[model samples]
Target chain A: MSLPGCYPLHDAIIAEKLTKYYGDFLAVDHISFQVRKSEIYGFLGPNGAGKTTTVRMLCGLTRISEGKAYIYGYDINRELVAIKKLIGVVQDISNLYMELSCYDNLMFCAEMYGVPRHQRKERVMDLLRFFGLEDKKHVKFKELSKGLKRRLAIAAALVHKPKLLFLDEPTIGLDVKSKRQIWNLICKLNEKGITIFLTTHNIYEAFRLCDRIAIINRGKIIAEGTPTELRKKVSGNKIIELQVSPPIKKSTILDNVDGIIDVNIGRDNTIYITINDAIAALEGILEIVKKLSLEIVMLNLRGADAEDVFIRLIDGTEKNIGSSTRR
Target chain B: MIDMLRLEDIIKAFYIAKKDIKEYYLKPPTISWGIVFPVAFTLAFILKGGHHAQEIIPGLIALALFFGTTSMAAASIVFERKIGSFERLLLFPVSYIGIALGKTLSSFMFGMVSLFATLVVVLPFILNIPTYSLFLVAVLILSALMFSAFGVFISFLIKDPTNTMMIFNSIRLPMIFLCGIFIPISSLPLPLRLIAFLLPLTYSVEATRFAINGNYDVVPPIESILLMLIITILLILLTSIKIRRTIP
Candidate 1:
């Protein structure tokens, strides 16, 4: 009854070969992913990659063209009303009522969700404080700063205490400090056992926060795994950077080098290489240096991280893992 | 059934509607549409009437109600759509019918409030008018509800505020002239009479006139009330269907 190494024992969110078409153009072409309860699941994709459309379908804002999604245990189509009651969404854009004050907006949402009058005020205050917008409770939504407005939207989404939460770029357009605050709040909410399904274009955010991520492009999921598994799959466990002189015909030399898979030319004639083992690769590069009498200005080694895997997958050079793989 | 009325969803709809209508009251242009324009039209007609002043009182009241309801519904939906507040409403637990009904009720209440103001403005002139106050109140309330639903139906068909106002004015001008809002139906020619009888306001005008003049016109007054009720029920049904289709 429990998923291994995750909070969502049962699938909190599930999409099976989901496809969406707008008129003739295929916006989403048979993508699928599962999000576990209490796990911060990141959906990473470029703009126009059908991430918003996918989230809308799961939230019941748009009908799926093919396949289906399930929230908690209910089908999105058949049990929409029940599913809607359980899930809450903070959209990329501000969906808060602008004319209303912070308290009024939350109160309106709470009333619509049928939260009892006796506890409504307490719930509003608690959510406001949680998002660090307690001081702006009396301010109109339009008057608040962009960060506070986003915080208000988060509070509005959680007003009903929905078990499943969807956050679509919660930190988009926010300053770095505001972005950190929102991320911290999101982490705290996940800690309280709320299942989070988030979509973002920020690679580092996904790498740092998500337990598992699905990389989508052109509506199809190109890759899916933990950050570590994905990095290891694309190149290896480490990255090696070597700065050398001009006339760098190291392509042939680097190709024959052991423990190295691929190399890319960095700025200032620096050569960055992906390797299976950092120490062995460094030793091989040292041997090549000694034999050729090559002078190395700088040599650095680091792990192959999510950014490496992402570029390779999108660059059309990654190995094929499944029949549905694009490149 | 009353318990159903007291459900949190229904109450929340009313709360939203009340908030929206109150905001409209605060806005100068919206206040003119909901209160000033309707009252102004009624006064213009009252001052223009000679011997037919008594006959025009109920007609002006119906006019006030019609303009008041249509303007508010059209304005509210267009404003919500413009600012993306409607999307927020869709996220709530409330059903589409609750929203339609709530907006309709608020429009109806606002129309009646404006009508009451118009009646007070015209009171000094109609000294000979009989006070069948209770019957008049009931008839006016029914007529207000009927037109409010009609307004909801109209609002859904429009997408732009400017175009909506243009369309509302185009339809309102002819109806104000042809629906016996400013003239007696009996005075109109036969073909126009048949056309006038088809409009919901024609029935409301007749019923309200009877309630005012104590005419007790045998067949027309009773038939008018029944026909208005029928039209209102049909409009509410249509609004419900349209709203349901819009949910996705």
Candidate 2:
């Protein structure tokens, strides 16, 4: 199928109630969203939140149990061949052939993507140079470092000149420097006019990389908006993070505290208390900790950001669904 | 089969096959396994068979091809599955059948080369006979393809490459004993001979015997060749369907 004129105008990805089931368990529940052209759309959620499953369905790696997805208006099920031409996927594992050299690996992808015979070599060399992998071109993939392998994996995906790229945890399991390097590449790729569909649990990554953020948890998109817009949605709210010794029950904090809108047990024995007024909420939290004989290790009062918005949306979604939807 | 014929997809499949050959089967150790194992097996059997060595050549040659094709055709894909490289192929534009066939092509080439290597070592002893190279070549080609497809079908039965290979060897070892690779079907009991006929290797070795020794009593050369083609087609279709289940 010809890919030149397949697009029905803008909107790079349109997923409507896209669902997936692994045997009897539901992995992705009817989640719908749209990714605008040349924009980075992120699915931000914690682990096992159906983010990877959604991305896999969009890339045609996994079958959709229900609902529909259209890539540039091309149906995923019926028009996958044409869709494959317009999209590239970089899975977290960097699943390129490990035994082949970096040059051979890119060359293989170029050939498989049906690049013109004459252009395969030049395109591969260009990618090697672009990714700063020219020196490592002859090195086998297994011999390269994790950061270099990730770069080569991204380079392989871009060899076909795909318009829409699906990055499933692009900076996953990378060191600080490697993660920043990947972040730069992502922005540079977006500047070159490629639409990116990124899924990550990294709050910093989503905050810095995405043009629009969708908060997905428990197989659904609870909230979707720009980073600033998402932050703005919760800006009226305030957060009091309490790092306490001998943590108390979240229910205890919620039950005794007045003016506390919500309480969640966070990682590392900390608690995130959402409130409208930080001063009044802090007094109530301190009283509860003192009564319980708990020592306050640290406390911080801050305005809501994307992470706060994420926790708020997830908390709201969990309460709205409640025990009836719990699996 | 029609879907496998698309020009671009077929070209992509060839490249996939090329990559597999380069990464897995073309290594010095692997090529040595393909070449040396057959020659060594032939020598061991010739010395053991003594006066019967002349008749054992055809069966050993068939055994060489069988081992060569089935081992790699299945191992390569399951290895990729373990290493996660096969996921890349699944995500590519190539059809499921194309990927399966690409694996088969690599194994088929390997089996053909093994057949040639076995023939080179044994050809001197058989040169005294009025051998038909065309018929022998035809039978070897079809058998290699059939054997390769058979391996592809079995690969879908397991996930881990190491376990898949273990199961493959367990099944292959039985087929070797049951097939006429060591014993003549004509000399075996009726039940054993019937089981041999049910196995693809029976026809492979019998047709080989007919081509090399001008003997055609147990099974006709053309019928054996035809059976190999039909079995190959059936297995290729089965393997393609099995490959599709990977997507879900």
Candidate 2 regions with alpha-carbon error over 4 angstroms: A1-8, A240-273, A278-301, A317-327, B1-4, B26-33, B127-130
Compute the lDDT of residue A243 as modeled in candidate 2. Answer: 77
lDDT tens string, model 1, A232-320? 66654466667775436545677777877677664456676767777777888889888878788887877645666676676566321
Segments in model 1 whose C-alpha atoms lie over 4 Å from true places: A1-9, A237-298, A318-327, B1-8, B186-198, B215-219
- Model 1 error, position A213 (Å): 1.5
Q: List the residue pairs that clash in candidate 1.
A: A8-A37
Chain B fold agreement for model 2, TM-score: 0.90
For TM-score, the strongest prediction is 2
lDDT of 2 at B148: 86
List the pairs of residues colliding in candidate 2: none
lDDT of 1 at B212: 84
The DockQ-based CAPRI class assigned to model 1 is acceptable
Per-residue lDDT of A320 in model 1: 18
